[model samples]
Target: MMSDCPVVSTKLGKVSGFALAKAKCPEAQQVYGYLAIPFAKPPVGNLRFKPPQSADAWKGTRDGTKYPPGPMQSTRYVEIFAKYVANYRVADENPRYFDEDCLYLNLFTPKTSNKAKLPVLIWFYGGGFSAGSSVGYHGQTICGLQDVVLVVPQYRLNAFGFISFGKNSSCPGNMGLLDQKMAMEWTRDNILAFGGDPNNVTLFGRGSGGISVSSHVLSPMSRGLFHRAISCSGVANCNLVTKENNDVSTGFLLKELGIMDRDPEIILAKLRSLSAKALMEAQEISAEYHENPLQKLDDFVTVVDGKFLSKHPRDLITDGNFAPVPFIIGCNNTEFCGVLADRFPKGFVTGEIGEKQAMDLTKIAWQVADNIPSNKLDEGVGLVKKEMMRYISPDDRYKWSKLPTNVMLDTLILLPGVEQAIAHSDAGNPTYMYYMTQQLRMHHNRAFSKDMTKKPEFCEADHIDDEVFTFGVPFGNGPVAKEMKFTEDEKNLSKQWMSFICNFAKTGNPNTPMSLTNWTSFKRDDQRHLVVKMPLEEGVDLMGERFEFWQNLRAKMATT
Candidate 1:
């Protein structure tokens, strides 16, 4: 008999988890879900600079009723980064809850009947190099809908995770990655107790989360940590720097604190003495780093410490020697729309036809951070939006061409998606690609619902659209748009996604019994994607004419 509610006693304590829904796994008995359990000792205060230590065993039955607090994030709403970039909102009253000690993971498990081991999927939330959390994200929805277990963890970000201290053992800026590794190690040790199979684990994420999965793919320390890897929307770019490039950004932040920093130990001690507000205040000086050349706020990146992650992520991917595991990866069609909108509001996205000034430098804020090769910088600066333009047809160009927003989706996002998918495929890894154009608009450009008659300008699948379906966190509190009217087509799309994912999880083949041609694996030289247009069919080239034009232009630029 399939059970809905099940209980498990963990090392920390006895806990109860209720399976919100039922789905058969390799073998199904009963299932339960638990949210917000500490996988490691929180990395706050003195523990901030140190690697993730073990979780101290608990004395009482711990409750996993709700998600734990998210990590110390930006000075804005929980989804401020998304709202700011995507021009959409996914916020709730979940006050931007943060703390350096934030280290939590949510779990969903099928009630196992003896030795039936189910594969696990660990989702890593991504928000540029800036902000994100696992809280409120739906782990149970996916797990219950499909028969796989789901786990999502929260890690430090920005200054906390990316703080660099040059070449010093005392500095552990990459503690964020260490936090993820610790959680994986924790799962290896404890997931079994929750009726999960530790041996078969897949690390997946979208956007920055995708980059995190890529990080693990390339990290030597991350080997054997996961069996399957999937990265969505976040490309090979936008990852951490190598060891040789670790700048003294933490020391600079300390200098902002009016302290002549000595070493990581001294800096951390001094930092710990300061209140959290004060620390955030110091990080604010990055505004100066944004404008000035000298006196730049030091770096805050995943330290390429020889001990932890041994190389820059791109190097590993290029060598065709990443964690040789089953791989699935792709990007969103409109990943850069919101961000480009933020940069060039109105129709400013159109570039110069002959002069070198047609593009907006601010459009690609991420690639500009590194002292990119002057040429690459120029290319990246214009490339994001230019590629977006490539996706619209000649007829549509007249409608969206003049205005930057029209082409923002295709150029900034889809182009990058194709680029990353090609890289993974060329690397001899089994890969998949997707172009999600399902823009969820409640009204005419308004985030919330509007009059029934009005249409929306921001109508295509903007950035982070894919994330919402992947993590089924419904709004129970705070403000949320009334786009809750998911059409039957949308629901069918979601169902297809769920079916495909579950199939992938079970056998590495996304093929459903019903040949849903809407989603297919890409072949080399076949620059096409599962055009997630309303009909959501899969077959061949989409926006082909524009794609060819953009490819030629991009190729022309690459040579120079």
Candidate 2:
């Protein structure tokens, strides 16, 4: 009989965890879960906008069964998008369920002796660093499948997390990243008690979470914390990750909140006094004032603070100053298709957006992707359109309608990911790359099928498609699983995908234990990358023409 509860003793105190239900991890005999383990003290009161403090020692056994409240954030946009656009359910983020003092982690480990020393995988969730929770991603399946320990850590979000008041102020930037660093430190110190090998840990995340993983690789403060890194869809060099003029944004925020003080100390004090809801509201309002299109995507994001990040990630990587760890980086084939579909619903459904509308949207996309000056905007748009038209005929209305999405795929996600991989490989670090082309069953575009009664055969994979399979969602009982009806082949594919991830975490190479295809390591000379889908074929020079077009265009733009 399984024990009603499993107890583990840590440096702080003893804690009790519950056994995972059999349905959650069907293959394993038992898996233990310890939820809501406090890694840092509450960042409230005077500690707001400050680095996380170590958790205080507790006297008695603490209950680690119930989930802690999610980090404070405004979930209105994400909630609407998930429900209406994606036709999917998101983790509940009820206002009452969010709290400012949300610095906790959830851990799952297979049944083993304390000395098992299994590999550790820490997940940093993605929500543009403004909204997300550790509640939805259950670790039971991964832990049970691979004899590994999975941990999900929660960090501060929105204004409370990334708001910076410039240098030498009471509030420096990247408190959210500092929260992640602290959680990593906590895992390093205490994971041994949970049968995990701290020295052999892997940090993996998607979207903004992926950016966090890549940021840690470049951060001097994060060295020696983890052995390997995996960034699924976002990288530090992408347009989404920016070192914006935070002073302007900070000023907007303070002015919105009726605090127009220029003094950092005064600003900090006033911000600390406001309620969490009020600060979040101010962040939402101030975000509208940002003219930079990239900042609109993520106003509160990772910055090159002198302490956490001394220089730009590109310069650091080129100078060989980043952590020398094995890396795996990739993105979905058409990462922005769903975004484009939602943005222009009629165009996608009708499959005819007309040439004028396509060109206009493409111009806007070019502005966002390349930051072309107003005088040179038309020139840049013409260059992009010329190259895009080379692949598709001028009269093909259906393909023309989707031109902007294609531009975003290359300029925003694919190009950045490939550049990072080449840089990492050139810097003498082992690097692996993948291009996820397999369309997920729960893909948002499926909802837009002309025949709503029948399932749509969408071919392109959108953003976060890789994440669904990476977490074994198809086989688990999460909200995503409830919506997706997986076939036997897809379930097997998920199992295979999880094996590759686990194998990488365990040995720093994905093709360990066994693999259907020999996964090749990425090299600058050949630019080899795996085309991840059914059968898993190895491909060389992924998007060679498109990558060259963007690279040459960027070079030309830089010179001009």
- Indicate which candidate wins on TM-score: 2
Clashing pairs in 2: none
Please, what are the lDDT tens digits per residue for candidate 1 over residues 314-400? 455556656766566655554544533333334433321222222433333323333334557555556545555454454542334
What would the per-residue lDDT of candidate 2 be over residues 1-560, giving only the tens digit for each residue? 12575688989998888776543445754578887899999999999999999999998988887778989887754552343122122223232378998999988888546689999999998777877878676665677677789999999987788888765666778899999999999999999999999899999998889889988998989999999999988887764564633666777788788886777888788888899888888888888887754465577776667788777666677777788899999888777565435555365645656767777777767666666676777777888888887877666656666677778777766787787788888888889999888865544334423222221233366776676677666656424322455556556677788888899999989996479888899997778888888868898987778888898887777678
lDDT of each: 0.58, 0.76
In candidate 2, which residue ranges exceed 4 Å CA deviation?
1-3, 23-26, 84-96, 291-294, 393-397, 444-459, 478-482
- lDDT for 270 in candidate 1 is 81
Query: What lDDT, from 0 to 1, does candidate 1 have?
Result: 0.58
Which 10 consecutive residues of model 1 have the lowest summed lDDT?
84-93
